[model samples]
Target: MKSLTLDQLKALAQQTSSPSISIFLPTHRAGQDTQQDPIRFKNLLRDAEKQLLGSGMGPREASTLLQPAQALLDDPGFWNHQQDGLAVFMAVDDFHYHQLPFSVEELLIISQAYYVKPVLPLFTNNGHYYILALSQDEVRLFEGTRYAVGQIDLPEKTPVSMEAALRLDDKQKQLQVHTGTSQSGAGHGMFHGQGPGEEENKVLIEQYLNLVDTGLKEIFREQQAPLVLAGVDYLLPIYHKVSEYANIMKEGITGSPEHLRPEELQEQAWPIVESYFQQETKNAVEQYQQFVSTEQATDKVGKIVAAAFNGRVDKLLLSVDAQVWGNFNPETEKVTQNADRQSKQSNLALLDFAAMKTLQNGGAVYTLPQDEMPTDSPVAAVFRY
Candidate 1:
């Protein structure tokens, strides 16, 4: 499955096509739920076919368009490695899919443009995050959202253990190579002892952590997602000193991460990351309220859509369940609101359009439910200027 990135969203936003098929469904990672994945996909495919046919495509042409999605239904292996949600997009010469960490409601929308609203949350600043679980015995990285988590492979240069990191010279060999943990109930690894042994071990551990942090920086350079460091209490502070990632949270899961599964790590780390997002959204809402009567912010759908397209919006608060069916003319900078979302109309979700444009221009986006929206209107925005 493709990892959905900002570039992918930009590409989709720029795409103008007809009879685009967008399908989203909740997927299972394991157990009996896996058995139901194929069946559910078949139903979505049939829905797409019906929509395609309703748009005046012949039966054979509609079948041809859906052929790629149908191939995935019979693939048993793909379902086994899934995350929490699956999104599929099909159009004229374009097909893309993403395995996301949050579950999405089953939705199918065939329209003039691809219905990307279902996956828009993933493109937002607070959608997902990284968990860097560090330990001398094992080092792991996890990519997670509130609903699902998955491990990411570390760089080859990362040290496997403390011994692997420090190569002692012949003079340092005078220090004893003790293996108390290897033969006993303690964790298996080599330990070195010397005068002021704790200080010496801290030095070596710092060096090892630096390597891990360097590797992590390479991976997270382009990401604004928060990184939570999970390890024993003692190890966390030292790693923080060496970590270069600016978004690392002050609070982390305190324990050995070696025994904790990826989902378990996610369970521990999500709250800390989520609190940050919650506070950010709250601050944005307060900012909008403070400037409610000013030109710096607005909740008018037409004005918000125009500002978003012009890169004048600094933040957007969109309702996930609300859709203002409309179309925009870039040449005229005019937006037309439709009375309803009917098939074959030049209609797209204005809420989605504002969110996408805000994100594409490096602005923040917060998607709330209809009840939780910042404004009584369908959308709200904070302008850049």
Candidate 2:
């Protein structure tokens, strides 16, 4: 799975191509559902082909354009390993796809440009967080959204266990066989570590954590999502001390994570991340309400859209599930709301336009539920002025 970034979103927004093919479908990571993934993808590809042909494209041209996506269906390796959702976009000169950790409704939209609204959730404040579960005997990382969690394969440099980290070649050589009798009176034996002292073990664990943090930095470059640590109490602080990520939460799940499943860890970590997002949105909403009477805030979609384009918007609050289909005239600085999509070339996703512009201009965007939007209107903004 490829990591989706804000830069890629900006580039997708700026792309100009006719008859762009966008396909999104839910995929399964395991079970019988895995067998159904390829079938779903093939169905979407067929629909995209029909849409392309209906848009006055030649059958051969449609086939040629969709070839890359079709090939994914036949590749056994691609279908065997899956995420929650797959988004594919194809143009005359550009073809790209990303396997995302969030689930998406199955849909195919062939339009003037790619339909990227589905991918917006990744950038929204309600997106994903990473859970790093560290233990002396085990280390694992999981990418989690509110709905699902998927474990990421660690790099080779990431030590999997204490013995691995200490470079102990033979398990038997490092173990001290205990033949003493148990308190229950039954004869028992155990394997105890014959290597490193307590202080030396701490040093080795710290070095392992440092390596993990280094690898994570590369994965989290330009990422805005918060990171939650889930491990035993002692290990958490050491990781915090070694981690370079600024978004690591001060609060963490305190317990031995060696035995917990990824799903179990996600269940515990989501609340911390959820609380953080709730607080952020609540503060932003309060600020917008307080500034409603001032020049800094407005609920009018036209004004917000214009402000977003001009880089005057400091923050934008809108409903992610709502789309105000319309067109904006850049020359006249006018916005017209359309009752229906008239043409692919003329009609535009106005909310998407505003969101993209706000993001590109270094403004913060909060996506809330429709009823929870800061204003009665679909869009609202706090201005830089």
Candidate 3:
């Protein structure tokens, strides 16, 4: 599966194809459960074929459209290395799949466009977060969303290991190892006193962290995503001191990350980002409520959908349990809300469309339960103007 990226999302959003197929399935990274992944995929394909046939497509045409995805059932290599979920998109002229870091609800949609709402987290503040795992031996970097984490490679010459990044003399190299839990188990950034002692080891460790921060900044320069650090209890503060990245989270995972797999580290990292994401959405909701008396925000789906198409939406909060099925004509600024979703072939998930346009036009989108919204509406927005 191809790595998910913004370019792919944009391409999917800009697609003007009919009878598009989008499929999602929860997947296992490894273990005995891996065997079930292909089986699940096979079932989803069968379901997609049934949907296509029901949509009035000839049987051969439907089979041909699904052929690419059907080919994956026999590929064991693909099944063994999945992330937390999988996404597949197919159209007459397009076919691609993304191995996602977070689990997606099992779904399949055949519509005029791809069903993209579930994957929005990967593109917005809700899903775009970073992880910096530091240890004496190696420093690892990962980009994560709400539920999944993927390791990102540091640039060439970036200091990944204490040995590689440090200029320690032969004596220091051998002694440069160690960490210890506080006797009380109640401290952070706590260095293990091993070879020379805590004071001397801290000096070297600080230098190592500085190098990491500098290298990371090259990639984080234009990014607004919050970053979480993972390491021994004491090292977090040292890295924080040397890092100028504005979004380093105040909280972090306290442990050695050197040997932890990316998914293993994700188990520790998601809560930090999820809390951050929730607070971000909360703040946006408050802004919407505060500006409700003015024109800067609104909960009306009609106004919000139009604004999203014109790039006026600064942030959007869509409800996962809601759908306003309809059709929108962006060129004429025309839209219709359908009480019956299946009454017309052109009806769209209007809420999903707004979320897609918001992302496409460089705005943030959050999917929250309806009760948590700024108003009782299924959709809410803070405008750019």
TM-score of each: 0.83, 0.82, 0.79
What lDDT score is found at residue 256 in candidate 3? 73
Q: Write the per-residue lDDT of candidate 1 for residues 124-160, one digit (tens) a residue.
A: 6565788888777678887777777766666667766
> How good is model 3 by TM-score?
0.79
In model 2, the runs with Cα more than 4 Å from the true position are 153-200, 328-334, 339-342
Query: What TM-score does model 1 achieve against the real structure?
Result: 0.83
lDDT of 2 by residue, 1-385 (tens): 5646677777887777877778888988889999998998898888888877777889998888988888887799988888888888889878888887788899887765677777776666665678888776778887777887877677657777656766655643465333344455432334358665545556766777887787666566666778999776667888889988888989888767778888899998988899898887888899899999998999887888888889998788978667777778888889887643646545677777888888778777888888998777888888988
In the predicted model 2, the residue pairs found to clash are: none
The global C-alpha lDDT for each of the candidates, from Candidate 1 onward, is 0.78, 0.78, 0.80
After superposition, which runs of candidate 1 have C-alpha atoms over 4 Å from their true positions? 125-127, 152-222, 339-342
All candidates in order of TM-score, best leading: 1, 2, 3
C-alpha positional error of residue 1 in candidate 1 after TM-score superposition, expressed in Å: 7.2
Per-residue lDDT, model 3, residue 123, is 64
TM-score of 2: 0.82
lDDT string, candidate 3, 224-248, tens digits: 6888898887788888898989899
lDDT of 1: 0.78
